[model samples]
Target: MLSPTLITVALAAAMIGALAGVLGTFLVLRGQSLLGDVIAHASLPGVVAGFLISGERGFVPILAGALVSGALAGLSVQLLRRGAGVKSDAALGSVLSLFFALGVVLLTVAQSQGGSAGLTMFLFGQAASVLRADLLPMAVVGGTVLLVLVLLWKEFQLVAFDREAARAQGLPVERLEVLLTLLTAVTIVLGLSLAGVVLMVALLIAPAVAARQWVRGLAPMVWLAALIGALAGSGGAVISAMGQGVATGPVMVLAAVALTALSLLLAPERGLVARWRRQGAARQALRGRQVLAALRGLEGDHATPDYASDEAMLQAYLGTDAGPALARLYRDGLIRPAARLAPEAAARRWELTEAGRLRVEEGGQHA
Candidate 1:
């Protein structure tokens, strides 16, 4: 029984997630994660400019303003990269501060006029503001951005992973980069209406960061990021509905952060816990092999037994020296005590079981 309002918020948030899948890949690959922050800050000026020109606080005009300002912000970054001989860090820092200042000034003037609605929401974001009218442009831009990212997946990866190599192979790295920057700007503009300028920033990049933790390559990362973003979006909407006066934009951001944090701790290959477990498992396997070898030499047994037999021999062969490795091997089923053997040597010879052999050869316990 989702209220229409909740339903709308959830849907929009999910759509936002889908949008982030594309935008995140580009940002991460280009090493421009901070650019999302820069563009978010820059959108203040864009919003004001849109309001100034449109003389009203409509969605289209505000988004248009956002687009222009965002483009300028990106353009400034490029100028720094190519023309000013400045690094991206310096360029983004300078432009972010400068554009934000201008935006603040204009916003002050606009607020002083005192007749607009939803103006301040741009500073933090207000997801509850989403309406049917806002969806059209967002749908168009979000869809287009996603579509382009999919179609140019190879090219984007080329630009992202090895720009020089991609260039050597004659890929249009420069043009594609420009397109990506513009696409980021457009995404910022679309997000502004719902998340506002400052808060929308988080939604832009958090899902992608989360996706990276969960994946090895670009495509999976993009898709995962989008799923994360969408879940956050919908979750935020639902929360805002239940909690009175909750801010939509910030809620969405928090959701993205939660997903990212979860990914860091839980993602299969790259997560902290997962990696630790894998390493531990590997070490265990190595230790098991060593213990078996020690017992094998001690028992004068050279290979005619299963893991269980190996365990039995190990107990007697190494005696007190069978050690922690011997115990672990038996516990993990890599070895066991042989029962049907000579009364004198039944418990003292070691051997590798099928699994034990595989473990020894695999090179990694996790494998």
Candidate 2:
């Protein structure tokens, strides 16, 4: 029941998402996540210029402008960081703000001139308006970016994980960095028509961040991030098509955020819920061992047949939560109440069973 145009738009968005996800993984690992944001915002001025020069909304021209603008912005950040001694964050922020403001001013001028009326759509993206012509450019650019990433995978990974080591090996670390930055700039440019400047950062980084939580290896993380980003892009497009007045970019970002939240709560090893469960099990095991150790210690110290078996003594020895441990130990035949104890006695004495003594002697209690 879906229309052809809608299908094309969805596919383009997915391609953009997959490309962004792959490149963004390195950005996240290199601690340059904010650099992605800066590149995205910086593309705006070039986009506006592209429209002005072409005098129409042509995907290729606009994309070319975007690529140039984005690269300059990314290079500016690097120069400021390395040459001017500006902090990385400050450089990124300064360039991002400056380019975005310049783009805004150009946008206003173009709007007043009355030739670029539809230019505002690129500000937040209008995926619903994507045409067949848009798909070709997206496929060509996205495919090229992906191919390059694969060809330089080892170099990029080396630089990202350990720059000092890469430099020690004489691996041309600075060239690799610049290449990676340009790659990221291209990605942001490609995504401009789909997710825009602001939402594109979320598209770039969220899937990678989410995938990192579940995966330890770089290869697995990259593929998983691409898959997740594709899903968000396609799903957001579909949802926007079905809804009224809803923007495609924001919806895609929300979908990515939702997946991230799910990963945070449910992923193994690092998830909040998993960590809580593990800690609870560990505490229980520790308490059980403590009770066993306490029972073993009391036998020789007290002359009352075995030792203090009363709730009061156990509580004093192991805090107020000793009852559960005591009950668990008794169930395991590690400890039991002393013989001839009154049923109504408030403080019945207890002793460790033979199994309990052997367990303590062998250090099995620590197990």
Q: Which candidate leads in lDDT?
A: 2
40-132 in candidate 2: lDDT tens per residue?
A: 888999999998898887877888898999999999998999889999989998999999999999898888888786777777888866788
The deviation in Å at residue 346 for candidate 2 is: 5.8
Give per-residue lDDT, candidate 1, residue 130: 81
List the global CA lDDT of all models: 0.76, 0.85
Worst 10 residues of 1 by lDDT: 299-308
- The worst-scoring run of ten residues by lDDT in candidate 2 lies at 299-308
Q: Once superposed on the true structure, which residue ranges of model 1 sit more than 4 Å away at CA?
A: 285-322, 330-367
Candidate 1, overall lDDT?
A: 0.76
- Give the distance in Å from residue 75's predicted Cα in candidate 2 to where it truly belongs: 1.3
TM-score of every model? 0.80, 0.92
* Residues 1-367 of candidate 1: C-alpha lDDT, one tens digit per residue: 8877677667777787668656876797778888888888998988888888889988778878888888888888887888879988999999999999999999888878877566878888777678766566678878888788778878888889899999999988778888888888887777775687777778878888888887787778777887888888888778767788888777878888998899899988899999999888887666666675564444345443343344444556545455577667767776555564667653454455566556655643431
